[model samples]
Target chain A: MGLQQPSFSLTALAAVGLATAMLCAASTPAEAVPSFARQTGLACEACHTVFPELTPFGRRFKLNAFTLTTKQEISDINERKQGTLSLADLPPLALMFEASSTWQGKRVPDSNPSAPAGSQAQNGTVEFPQQLSLFYGGKIADHFGALFQVTYSQPSDHFTIDNSDIRYADQSQSGDFLYGLTLNNNPTVQDVWNSTPAWGLPSMTPPVGLAPAASPLIGKLGAQVAGAGVYGMYKDVFYLEGTVYHAALTGKTTPIDSTSGSHLDNYMPYWRAAYERQWGRHSAELGTYGTHAHFNQGGLNPENGLVMGADTFTDVAVDGQYQYIGENHIATAQASWTHENQTWQGLLNAGGTSNSKDNLNQYKVTGSYYYNRTYGGNVTYTRLSGSTDALLYPVGTSANGSPNSQWETFEVDYLPFLNTKVLLQYTLYQKFNGGSNAYDGVTNRKASDNNLVMLGLWTNF
Target chain B: MKKVFLAAVGLATVLAHAASAATESPPKLAREVCSKCHGPEGISQSPLFPRLAGQQAEYLDQQLHQFRDRSRGDPHAQAYMWGVAGPLTDAQIKSISEYYASRKPVHGAAPSDPALAAKGKEIFFNGLEARNVPACAGCHGEQAEGQGAIPRLAGQHADYLYRQLRDFRSELRENETMHANVQSMTDDDAAALTEYLASQ
Candidate 1:
């Protein structure tokens, strides 16, 4: 696909307002109702490069968690817990509240008494969660089952209702056609991997930060999958899902990044899709997704007082996962390309220079062993190369050069209980790029690397 | 056909139990050995052992079972419990489950900082950059909901919360990130935060 200019795209969108509304739901953060990222005893990494994808395990997880069983571990909640009931009592509503607290290296609170007893990592700092969510899962009719979740976060106490889907799921049905779809927002097969999205991974910066930056652009809590799309099963083995929607509204229409000025929103149209096949314990999946920025004439001005117009950005990726279950070993590999040659492409405004579609290619390979069961470990290496397109300026500089940078991560996950897990991870970063496009005043000269250690506990009811 | 089916059902139930049952060692001598301190079914009726009954199975597995030789080192939990915790291999320790898993979690002490939880809520959802504190949700969970190995901090006993925070700061409770996360908080913050969490 080819990229376009900014000002021109906006005029076209202005001419077609209602048409745009149907394509784009209001531009705020889309909150898919929060569902357990993993259903059953299935873990996140099983489906996604990280979590929440439909790897065989992930897909099976959904079937098992939501459809297969309604026998939840007994608790005090008064809501309906059964998955099967007569049509009169078919649709059910459920709710769960979860919270967390963690400590990291040198960041441990002054009050942590265990600080001394723990390894050096615990001597650091900690993080936690403040969240509330409501879930609604039931058979809307005979063949259709509904899955919807709404989550509320702290601070502004923003409430998001997203991650809603309606599926004509019949595991018994075989052939080239199976079933899944979204009435509002939807996630393609690719978004299953949290690390794949803009704010979800690599970086949260819009058009500008498309390159590299000093701070982490990745957020652990995943972004919601919304918009409109559908997914299905083929012969009970192959799987496919696709979605088209408006990306989360950056808020500031004036095309600037999260930190550019008062922090405006970024709006763009996008589509994503993926395909997968399961051959016994071994399986593979392939997917691609991209976004197009449409300049909204009625949008706000850029932080710098520039009349921010519409912009476009798109990313395509092919990933494969293979698992050796008998011995409990899993391996994965993926390559992604983000083409920024589109109108909204490039890091900061390319300083008004001749433009080339910004091209970024990145991938990772990881393998882990069960090491019996309670003790398991994995090692992975990832390299992300950003575009030198004029649009990617300021924040996108890699430490090694102006083109490529890399991060190596190693993690150990121990599941002591069927419901609980502990993950210890170490990440090494390498940035190798430098250039002044539109944002950063200085370009990096020497390659730099930082090491981070993360230890976390995750559980569910 | 019905008789055969019933027989098969009986067989299946037995088989399922055998498959999932934790590797049994010295069968939990609930009264003879455990009751000396932990009370029956590990409820700790004495208020000292901190009732273990009805606890999330995962939480119990982690505290008494995960750590090896260092298992009994926790200062907050009773020392005798630690001694018991030390010899537990994964399956052996699992033999001793809590009564709480099947029971409801009851409140311990009354709230002191009546508004503390509300204040803590402020910090939990939002970061306290002014106090150099990050938001609690960044790790624990949204709405105080605990995840897979992380304990459900919300709705826990305030006294237990205070003791845990104190133990973490003192290096008595050597869990994962909490050891470090707690290191930054002041005792007051921990207590206030605990009250906040408990109230939630």
Candidate 2:
């Protein structure tokens, strides 16, 4: 089953009626409550500039372990009431549903050229209800909390676990030092900022037929690994974290692919460092993160010597973010770049990849502005490029042999209720699979033909 | 391609104008909408109105929502905030709270009786076991800057605090926990406590 794509867009419109929104609750949760607001007894404004876009307080809330509570509690009395403990008092449970429609610039030709008469996708398709989700989000104990989500995608007709980040964190101050620990399941999922690949924009998007074909390895390890790390914020200025991740069984009971092995040969190391400062109305952050991983060439079969060997991949990323918050307006800018080095020795031995080594790169930047917290808009541009290997991508023309792609996204959002949002988004493609025109070569499909428009309603009770 | 870029730029310009027109500073909103009763910069001219300056933003936001939802039904709340909060959008509520939180606070007038003020300080820092009243500083900070969702109690108007304590004890205010805590306190106790907090 395919996972629900995090469709990142601006906030929704507010003037829409609740009854009308509920009737149109044909969509899934974008910024659902999931007990965080209720547990903290604060509104969304406390944590987000807009939904999923964190404010300074929101970042602190995450780093402090999501343990702040307003419910009745029983404290654990050690020598000095050491760590506060409260009941899972409030049911940390919530549900979300969504309905959506996609309008493409041109009709999608048949997937199989041999069967041109076969059914083809039209220019516009309406999903009665696109997605549904259940969330268990909030504090698990005094120093531990988790945001666990399970989603059901209507188009894929399947259920799967979605984005989840469980953390064990606690802070202690030694004059200028404040430090904490986090044990999580995903690489960038524990991050407080949206500039990270895992939680970054398009908070929600179509699960199929919309994204680019290639991405850095940093974007590929969400549900397939577990990690633990320690972080510290020095005088609330410099931040650092170092973690190691190991492969976890993915795809439920699906058999492991013997050729393109999905299991890891050894632990992957990830690290992040950043400097942040906030002065009055403005805040800015500049940071870098990187990871090194080695995966088995073939399936991790105990008896197979060839399968025991490994292929290595190393990924490095740098990112920055800035925000200016005012009573009447909020403005933000974010950018990130990722580069991946792939050594395909193991894969080539297993007869998987075409080359021994390949390099890939991804770059993205977005700017957003919100007026009166009621109306807002954003623009994003992204580019992806990689080393050329004909055997690796022999599907199309000479341009398609190169892994170069680019996309542009524009969105506007309106919020009538702080907790409710309506959005209209448009996306454009400059290049797809290395070609701006005749991308697929055989079907005569152009990258521009894939332009899409979407309207969505997102809310939580 | 050029046309699309130009069109996007045009849309952005229009949207930016809309943003500039739609937005207003929180301080401006506070002065125009809240200052009539709470006083300029949240220092109240009337004892009946609570001092709002330097109050916790979280507390103000919560109270505003409560008032809007009619969960806070004190006589004054019903008479004043019910109407004020009814028409406020969430952003307005946040702006108003943040504005007040950032405002400079002014101390209320000292009580005429020093002995009463001293007694109030005792109650403020130390709980009275005989009455099951917890120390005010246990939850509110020593100087009452507030933490998390708790409200700041320092340097507030004595009359307003006294009235609230009395209201809580008399069931005129609807806070279940606060009412229970104040139930056994006498009028003198309420008076002394308010004076002590105001002195801070």
Candidate 3:
């Protein structure tokens, strides 16, 4: 046997579907699902404005998406003789969904003996999906199409619609020159990376010095929607995008001035640019993203001896990826380094309230292999650290931001079925400083690790 | 010299034709084995059963592999498909996938109603922006011809579209990309987009 087909359990198909999406999925795109697009040998834009997002064509692909192998052929839209709309070329409203459930290895200590009594669970259990979504991908117009979708889960009732966007694209026969726009709503950087997505620093384990889940640094809710962005591709190689949006609700910001209750409320402007080049089986990209904001918060915390201050953080990253594409084998490795910084450390006293400014550095690497039906798997590792220690506010009052030495993670994906998969993973973290998660006395800080067992379903729709 | 070149070209054309004939769907696997449930030539008439004819080769390979590996969740179909899809090796999947994709789809008729088609087109081109509805043609294409991973939407089933849009708006579906787009859309947009897409 070349490789045992690895398939994970599919529990809580609703809740886990989203977790998998946050971890394994990359970038928010509007179009047919990635696996489906990959199967069709069609560029994502053929049906989507972005990856994992859908357009009209993307929606059609979903209707009858799963039964491709059984199909006879793709009818040419132009060849249809009698109908105003070519029935021969229409796609279906088929779809693919996945979910998984994970069991965490770490134990929850009994801080209060009288707390809600529960099982001292040791063996981890996970219920979520590798791909759980209800989608419609296909053509909606003579030329335009889309992927419309929504996902239902626990913790919230009303179904949340996402990954929906519209697109109009054009490409020459030679496959050069692609132009289009995507009208959509997506989370900001903070919201997009909320928690330690399997893709980001492990949310399972908090960094050294900082409290993991305990920190006020929870991921932001998605914002910055209701806008149109332009995307262009030259020679089917170089690519670019530009967009703008206003936040729905004014962000809750840190105090920026000593004056009680006086703050700056303004619409933040964000811009991101990236360049990618592929060589052989590898591709490399360099990118920079920036956002400028004038914050305004409530009155100063005079009781806590606090003053408001204006701040901004600009981030930049360098990334690279390589793919080993063979007739029967496929493998890929990708890595990136990101740096972030803010202004204002100088105004506040050393390790004082004004010292909230920070500079951080992060790095990640992941690899995946798909060897024809015999076997397939993927593994990824990431780390994040700080150039200068972050400051403490509400808690850990006198503590200084420690260098984030422990944002480490490891994950493994097993494809037991031909195209289906189950992934299991674990992560370790340490926050050696006195910020967020750390709150031991004045500098509440310590090292923490998390063992997560994830089992879920992954498939091509 | 020119006459000789023309003769050579003619010979090459004949040879190419021979090559085409030599490449055929695996003889053992025919419509008899697959069409019984999937419908003639792998296309389906039932709304629930997806049409399979005319899908791309890679797509077929990927799905077959997913099912065989058990990475996808479908216990309902597993009882029926497990044995058949499992025994096939990678090489077999590739060939079968190629053979099926190479076949063309049997044509069908367009919807008889023109009013729905016209209304759907309006939504496709110019969305209700005041209501924050975005146009569909902005990204997919003026003609709905997709590129790089996007699916083709020109022609599809109306019931399928309607079912999906409702699923999305109602949260029965949890899609990351389209979920947000649907969050603000009214039921009308979903209906309009569905009707338009199905008509396409």
Which candidate leads the pack in DockQ?
A: 2
Q: Compared to the true structure, candidate 1 yields what TM-score?
A: 0.46
- DockQ of model 2, rounded to 2 decimals: 0.02
Reference-based lDDT, each prediction? 0.42, 0.68, 0.42
Worst 10 residues of 1 chain A by lDDT: A202-211
Task: Specify the highest-lDDT model's number.
Answer: 2
> DockQ ranking from best to worst?
2, 3, 1
Off by over 4 Å in 3: A1-96, A109-125, A128-132, A172-174, A187-226, A249-274, A278-290, A293-311, A344-353, A387-400, A403-405, A416-419, A430-448, B1-200
Off by over 4 Å in 1: A1-66, A69-125, A130-141, A146-176, A184-186, A189-211, A214-225, A237-240, A247-277, A287-308, A327-340, A344-356, A389-391, A395-403, A432-449, B1-200
Worst window of 10 by summed lDDT in candidate 2 chain A: A5-14
The digit string of per-residue lDDT tens for model 2 on A246-314 reads: 766556443445543455555787888999887545789999998988866444343574454676878
Error of 3 at A199 (Å): 7.5
In the order shown, what is each candidate's alpha-carbon RMSD? 22.6, 17.1, 23.4
DockQ of each: 0.01, 0.02, 0.01
